[model samples]
Target: MGGRVSEPTTKASQFVVAILAKSGNIVTLYQLDVNNAFLYGDLHEEVNMTLPEGYFTENDKQTEGNMFISLFVYVDDIVITGNDIDEIKRVKTFLNSKFLIKYPGVLKYFLGVEVLRNDENICISQRKYCLELLNDYSMLGSKPANTPIDLGLCVVCSPSEKDNLLSNITKYQKLFGRLIYLTLTRPDISFVVQILSQHMHAPLQSHLNLSFRTLRYLKGSHGKGVRMVKGNELSLKAYCDADLGKCKLNTRSVTGYLVYFCNSLVSWKSKKQATISSSSAEAEYRAMGLTACEIIWIINLLRDLNINVKLHVELMCDNSSAIQIAAYFS
Candidate 1:
């Protein structure tokens, strides 16, 4: 799916260069995205097909398997990620050999989010994406809202009034999906995405309204992205958060964990726990245990990087009792 187009590199690509320049790292950069990634494959089972652009038919002698896999394309944009500069360059070279390579160096932008590489870190955000979303939804002319959610504005709706609520849900659901993908590079939005996701199944008007609030928040913090800078050598650290009794429906707490490698963020999670905890300590401990599990996996990943973490993968939590429990339980 690697090929070239008329456009320059992604916005994130530009931001990455700026960030790297700021950090004074001898950073090397390259860029490529999945080539006609959609065109490359076909639905294995029965499905309706739609005519694609720049359509070309294969020879009569060509078999289905011989047919070129159409890499999916969104107006020529594609998704590709890599860590090794040499490897990325290699891929770019190979793609150029096959298709016209539009040389967009380094991934400055992906999925509308801007990226910057600074001081041993990679920062990503979607301030621009947010603006576009607002404009696309016609919120550009509408007044900006102050909060991501209005706690006093309840979202509960009755079944008979489902139509209005359902409409809002559909709108918000679409946004939530986008935001969820956005979480890949922006952990700051994880909590809100998680909160909004709970209502996806039966989104009411209130739910949709809150979703708009989230969009407003994004508007305010548009172009924000994570900066995975190298930190204090190659060490593994984890931070966890849990909100006990946060959900009114089930009284279930929300738990979150983030994993960093050599001070660069690698993994994160935010979700509701299965069961309710009796106390803050219990809740914190549950979250800590989950965070530890992630740490273990991260440890294995780092091993492949030729990095070894000698001490315990440190887990940080704001709660003292949780810290004590982690000390004894882990």
Candidate 2:
């Protein structure tokens, strides 16, 4: 018997790249599922073998020319989109010849994320996932909160006052893990989730309270999600900001960035800096550096997909000092 191996999967960012491309260009998005999908290698020497009960052989494709096909694969599930309809059909047929395939018309839902096509733009959300998360945690009836966390609240690792640790640490871990996944379509809660994730090892009661508050916040805007709009050009821009000494425990800065591809946000992150910054300007500079790295990666990704970015990538930093430093370094 031959052992089965997983297919070479594309990066998760490719999904965002596909969405951005579809919004800006004339392309059709489609989904495919391969029955008993498995990749096999050729035998070194010729060996005769009988077909096991029911078995068969199959095929694949790539992107080029006016015919552009962006394929994203996760195990057996596949998403295919391209500028040329004829090319897409040819590719689909080729795939079908090699393996049993299912054509699910357009890509409406995949991996829990709902894809909705509108006349003007494309909207992706996890509304069903959100509701299910709340229901699972018995938070469906919880009162809705206006914010994920209090604006002025300061979180510390060990509170001066006595605080109790959560008894069922696993429950808190599971809840936190779910919330982290929910951030895929809910960037609004990313910051709070990043903050709470630090205490996963042994969450305290206070941390649980904060996590519940985030759930309440999610309840208030469960329908909230990212929207991908068509852009006039494939230009890249980034916005970066940082809070000096934001982490109460380590005094480390918290930095965040949003990367926009042709006016549509393609990537974002909110996380604490690895090292402490001496000043606000330094923190902002560190944030800018992080954003620059992401922008470079995005540009390379676009280039790989045959999408050329014409203009210079822009980085917007609020701190004048940080900007000056960047200019000097350049």
Estimate TM-scores for all models: 0.68, 0.85
Local accuracy by lDDT, each model: 0.62, 0.81
Per-residue lDDT of 68 in model 2: 51
Cα lDDT tens digits, model 1, 186-259, are: 67767777877887778766666677777777666666666666544556778998989777678889899987
* Model 2: per-residue Cα lDDT over 1-330, one tens digit each: 111211267554557767777765567688998887655344487443323433433322222134456677878888987778888899999999988899888889877789887778888889999999999988899999999999988776874356777778998899988888878778899899989899888778899889999999999999988898887788988899999988887999999998888788788889999999999999999999999988877776676556788678889998999999999999
Highest TM-score against the true fold, candidate: 2
Name model 1 segments beyond 4 Å from true. Answer: 1-29, 41-103, 118-122, 150-164, 261-266
- In model 1, what is the error at residue 149, expressed in angstroms? 2.8
Count of residue pairs whose backbone atoms collide, per candidate = 40, 2
